[model samples]
Target: MTKPKRFHPFYIVVEFFNVIKYWVIPLALSLVKDELSFSWWQYGMFAILFCLFVFDIIRWRMETYTLTGKTIHVNEGVFTRKVKSIPFSKIQNCNQRTPFLYKVVGVTQLKLDTGMDGDDDTITFHVITIAEARRIQQLIQTKSDSLETKEQQEVEPSVITKEERTLHFSPTAKDLFRASFTSLSMFVVIPILLSLYSKLDELKEIVPIQWVEDQAQSFIVQQTWIMMIVLLIIMVCISFVVGIIRTFLKYGKYEVSSDKTHVYIIQGLLNESSFSIEKKRVQAIVIKQPFLKRLFRIAEVKLISAGGIDHSEAKDDINSLFPFLPRKDAEAMISTILPEYQVISTMHSLPRRSLWYKLSIPSYSWILSTAIIAGLVIWVPALQPYTWLLYGVSAFILLLSVLRKILAYGNTQYVMNGSYIQMKHGGFGTELFLTKRTKVIDVSVERGPIQKWFDLATIVTSNRGKPVLHRFRLSGVPIPLADTFFTWYRERDQEISIVNEDQKK
Candidate 1:
């Protein structure tokens, strides 16, 4: 057992950033200070920051953690202390997050996931040295291994040997290039550009935003076609650069491998990050393709594990197993990681009545909108002259909506084989959800009045997750298929329960 210890001395900087989040109002106030009438508001904001800083100092002094052989204990709060004791056996994931700033400070934040639905039950070390975080992770994993060994020895006295080998994968240069082109992460540049533009006041000397805007407007007025071409070229260049940077930061030298009991993921460039999860902790698998990625025949595979923490904009994105792989390669990778749940694409097609069920709402809404638009043009004398244009736009919108519904209906599928369940959905691109029968926490079959008349239903399966209930839905499924799926789930769950019991023995 290690003695209870305080965080690294440099961790106060990270604590400062925590309090800085509360300084947003003050920051905004400072930006508009010259325009404001009351000057005392600035002083008041300073007072607030000062108080928060003092509060964090006290909280930092009060917080302490200890790692014993079997558990990690955390004590929090300044006056009213709250203690959390997390057993190693309950831990599903030990993930380390190194924000860009944290990397500069040489510290990491450790998150301990316990297959729970809320953060209240999880334990976190907000700031610790990278070395200390890794040591703690190793200790917890060691304790878990010991505990499992003890249980196994108790269950069966006979000696048993299991094969132990490491299966490893690292992205090739070609893979990286493909992933960069296929990544949706370039969309991050939109927000980055917007943020910079918003703070143009701060960058007036460096950027000369007003001058640039004037130049662009003058060019557009003088040489419209040339200006458009130049703008398009600049946009493409910026997007390409941003995509390369994002890809390198995310997948550069990426390595994902699994040992006997744990899956390890390592990636990132400047702020290197690593994460590991027990094989048993994985709840579900999702294979996805964006419309553009699908055109390139690239797919992404992600493992849904229990983590109470939400994926906020500021947090690092979940690193999928393979960010961009050929569709066949992605399936082969899934088989390597989870052999039991083989990828099956031969799904039962829904009846033509299902199409009616899918398009019913959108079709009706389009009709109602068109009717209202036509009525306005016909009754309003002033708008009567532009009736043709209104009709043309309304018809286009109706056609687009109907086409989307048809595509989505045609792609949707539901399949249950043995202990595995899969649901495919989406319109332009497809999303395939795969999970074991034991992973499903709830099953729901919904039928509206219209769906009932058409003998169609929507089947939803909920799996374990945090904050949001992870749901996979198969809409416009035949009523019989829905019933069959529900029955299969019930039967498979029971069978899995028996098998689990046998494994325990």
Candidate 2:
């Protein structure tokens, strides 16, 4: 007897939904054009024809993905069927995303990523059961292990078991409160309130005009102290609500675990997500405590992986693995998880040459402020009282620009023993990044005409996806030394690449 062909049940349903969704948008637009006295024919033709073409194109290109014992095979294309086979050994990471809608349909989306491409170079299988996905992942890993020789296999464990580790420190109510209070949501509220205020006239048409007018008159007559108190209470309430929602969305049920080779993160409230970071793939570790968060001694940790996170899904991935932790605990955790990088103690200072480069040179802010002041003086005489204020502000800005240059001077330090480099500078919200030497893709020393006179150079290091540019005024270091450092960084990166290649072999 022949074996029955197995089919992915959920993918079929997803494709059906996709076809309906394609039509729904055009149908809605057609209705809108008929009701309004607009160019109906143009919109009708574009919407219907465009959607039809998209539907046919997508349907034709859609492929069926199957995970076998040794590799993943994807068969796709319309006029000509194309098949792509990737050996399990080349698979770098597997991610699972379950949306609220997906959960209802008992399916999850699985994305397979490799080291060779950007985050978008992922093969997704929609509408697969979580258990089935895990099973497929294990099978791939097992096949990948079989490719290794006996001696190499013996050096490391054949398989890593998934077990939950008890966290020594869990977030308490106080911790949650501190995190929420320090959140960027506080700043976001001001913009929302301003938008509402601007639309007050329009809102009055919908609301009772008499009631709004009475409230406006009362607001004008209210005592300053009473109004101040009321505003304070309102802001506090808003902050509390924002904090609670941010906490619940970001940190709810967050878990961290590690095996010999990977750090795993499982977190979410409504929709759960799981990701594993291989020790070898990490490029840099950034620990940031914004000005507000510093008051509560809380920091956010980010691991810049080879390809990093997908830009399209940044909001979803921002809270993924990038956990909010106490500053002290985050420091200790980094020491353990990434022993290759060290956190060094150093004072923030800019190179001496930075002073000349910053103050003497023109910046975008200076040009913008000047233009605005010029426009106001020429056109809006009503803003004449603000003229004196602008002059004082410009003077203060000039002083700051000079001070900023002085403060930015610093010695670039590379912690060679741990294979990490640290560059410190002077500025508001100054940061220290610890990145692996091997992860540095390219290093260049750049100097423009302005920098040439001041004897300043900007050192830029390119990782996989984008480059991190660090500007340093030469201060006292000889240009020859800076060139040597650039060469050394490049050489180190090449050496690490060869080593990783050999290990793979």
Candidate 3:
């Protein structure tokens, strides 16, 4: 633990790709120059790449990280030297990712993060062996526990260290099948197929694009009903199979567990990723039921912490409890992971009068479309015969807008129990956001002209998200309830101050 260390030697390769992504397209096009000798720009490119590699070597020599008894120290700078030391007690989350490339090298990247300044919030070891990563984890755990014991001794001299980990949830094969279907991963293949189809003309020298298109049309788009039906069935089967493979690869070996202090998650079959977050660092809990998940009566639960999970794989959103789970399963996970917060089922719905106010809000889309249709009919006399048709389209769109508002009104709800507040709102699908009073940074009540007539108001609360502030709005809340929300948040001042004092201690 006393020895100084640097990143794995592969960092030179990493730096090349970092700059290559920007130059790859130009470089690829340059290859088509058909020049016998290298062009001047090509020479310049090689020189740039060579200089980049040399600088990376210099970087590899200069940067060194040391693991000490109480803190991690990193010293690295090109021109001017800089030093950073982070106490293990301040660490909030840790994640280890072994991407395909890293797996090939038998190494992984480790990230330790805190809830502090963005620049100094995270320290990452871009390349380290798995054993070294595990050793660092153990050090952080032991050091943080000892620090916690000191804090307890400040009040009443007692040490409590319980390292019992319990398995909370793991997806079964059936669960994976359901997740694959609900994820709509089949659509991923369609986009790939369409991309290849669009680019087929580029391969005209080898493949006949027109002939392929004609064949595709004859069997598909410009075909009889029976042929079209058969093609659709084939597509469905292929998409389903693709979705299953994708789901199994990504969600396979997924496990969720927790100890006395942290929630742990490890997933992926090949490109494995594991994340751990302290229970107290969680800022909020979001229960999302998208259109597809809602259809299956399932939801995805996400824990919003200051030191968030990997942001690059945004679709999977690594902080999520499980990308696919039933409502009951997510609820139970919430209770088990963060028992201080509760996921309530029913809340106060919007009163009938709120519907009138919502509907009264003018539809900009309807107005804009109606004007376009009118202009089209007037300018093009050829369209006079189809004026009724244009009007029907406009009416249908307006009807859809009205239907959406009705659905929104029916879904909107709000409730506050003690120190926790939950808000549910959306049209086609619902999102229930729950957070404690101290977690809410801001709260406001808006009573617009229409809302005033109905004695209704919109209550908005803001919380700390991964790297952005997340705001949730609950429309159609009674004015009296809005006052209650504001008051409840205001009461958090004393509690927040106590937490600050504890952290200072």
Candidate 4:
């Protein structure tokens, strides 16, 4: 019999860092001990506590390191050993994240995600070399492929059907730059400039006011043409630098590919990361383009996967598949990648009732701005002019909101085909989502007083983590249509359950 090849010893640098992190509080306390006049016993107790905590982390790391052929087993505990073995077949995605320090040491952290469990169940292995991590990933993929092949053979031919498909690749450099230029970054400059203006008084304290006045005078009078040329050159250089850095960080060596069953995405500059999401595990898809991006014809595509971090704080429930893409090409690619989904047509005009709602007493923007202005007027008399200007601005904003609400009101539609639900929605750039009906966890309907009076309802559909709210003005459609939608969604779930039961038999 041939002997199995042995790999190099697993590096424990990350484990060492984990151990040392526990001493940070004690070390800080020791630094302040002389000033605070701490007792010897207290010092000794702190040291002992730090040591215990450090040991506990080391023990946890040791238990967590695991390897397997068909699965990777991670067992962690200080007191109770909790073992989790995630099968290779269950792994829906894997990603590598490396911090600057890890990059210096040529190491990367691997995160393995199995769609079967929530974000907490995912495993992370830190301080592994990039080459070794890649090797492990490839091995897992191979094992998964073999298992799938075996399972296919064992199942009856009539029971299973293969869905063969090709995938769209990532965009090129030009495409990335075009998309990124239209990103929030472009509009972000205005806020940054305003912040600089707000802090000008503080900045004047750091530099002599006389020096700035002297420079301004010289630029305006003595060297006007020369200063203008220099400023223009500087601005051009800054813009170029910004564009290059943004592209390098976001789309550096971006690649997207797929087999019949999964979509793979690999990207990054300093630290390469990759994600493989099985088709069936995707919960939803969202495509959005801010007003600025719309002008440049660019869109961002996001995927709401069954597994990954929960971004409840930011109210972002989806993760980006392609962070940036040209609007026209992205729409084309979606159709090719997920042909079953149909992009819904966004409304060009709002119902009269929706228009009235926007112009009514309960306008959120008006109420918020009024509160802010009131607080500013009460606290800072010197800022009263600014407050008055803000109040005037709020009136304009309220008008704009009413106009936008009229223009942007629309209903998202979802089509049912067997076990799959195809969803679509967009204001600027269209998005199409296809998810198994069985994956939906909940459904809800909400109405505010204004919406109730206007005969409007906001329908929310949830999967595992959070729900996607679709605001539909009921005045535009017959009441029966909403009932039809609710019925379709409920029946779809029932149909999926029956299908699963039949498959079991």
TM-score of each: 0.84, 0.75, 0.87, 0.70
Per-residue CA lDDT of model 4 for 1-505, tens digit only, reads 1222222223344555566687765556555644667778667867876676677556644564556656676666667777677777776667666656777877777777665544345777755778978777776766655554666646653443433435566667776666556553434444666897687675464345768767988767876687889987887667666766766676665776666666677676665566666665566666666666666766777656656543543222124657567667776666666564444443233345655664563568777887887788889889886876878877887777665555444533445565555554443344545555566666556667776777765555666422223221223322344575577677765677787887576
Using TM-score as the measure, name the better of candidate 1 and candidate 4. Answer: 1
Which run of 10 residues does model 2 get worst, by summed lDDT? 466-475
Judged by TM-score relative to the true structure, which candidate is superior, 1 or 3? 3
- Which candidate number has the best TM-score? 3
For model 2, the stretches where C-alpha displacement exceeds 4 angstroms are: 1-62, 77-82, 118-120, 140-149, 152-170, 186-232, 294-297, 318-323, 346-351, 410-415, 466-480, 490-505
For all candidates in order, the CA lDDT equals 0.78, 0.62, 0.84, 0.60
lDDT of 2: 0.62
Model 4 residue 461 CA deviation (Å) reads 1.0
Q: Which candidate wins on lDDT?
A: 3
Give candidate 1's TM-score: 0.84
The TM-score that candidate 4 achieves is 0.70
Where model 4 places Cα greater than 4 Å from the true spot, the runs are 1-12, 15-61, 77-81, 99-106, 115-120, 139-148, 151-167, 184-236, 310-319, 344-354, 357-361, 371-391, 410-436, 465-478
Candidate 3 residue lDDT tens string, 144-217 = 76665765656754553558899998899999999898988878898999998787766664445788677976
TM-score for candidate 3, please give it.
0.87
lDDT of 1 by residue, 1-505 (tens): 7888988766666677767877775566565655545477767877877887788777778899998868889998887888888888888887777867788888888888786644455788888998999888777766666666877766874655443536567888788878887776666788888997788786664444898888977877888687789888898788888888888877885778777777777777767776788777788888998888889998888878776335652255454776788898889877887676689979877789888877777577678889999899878989988988888888898888888788888888877787888889988888999998888889999988888889888999898775476898888888778778878878866777798897688
| Two-way TM-score contest, 3 vs 4, winner | 3
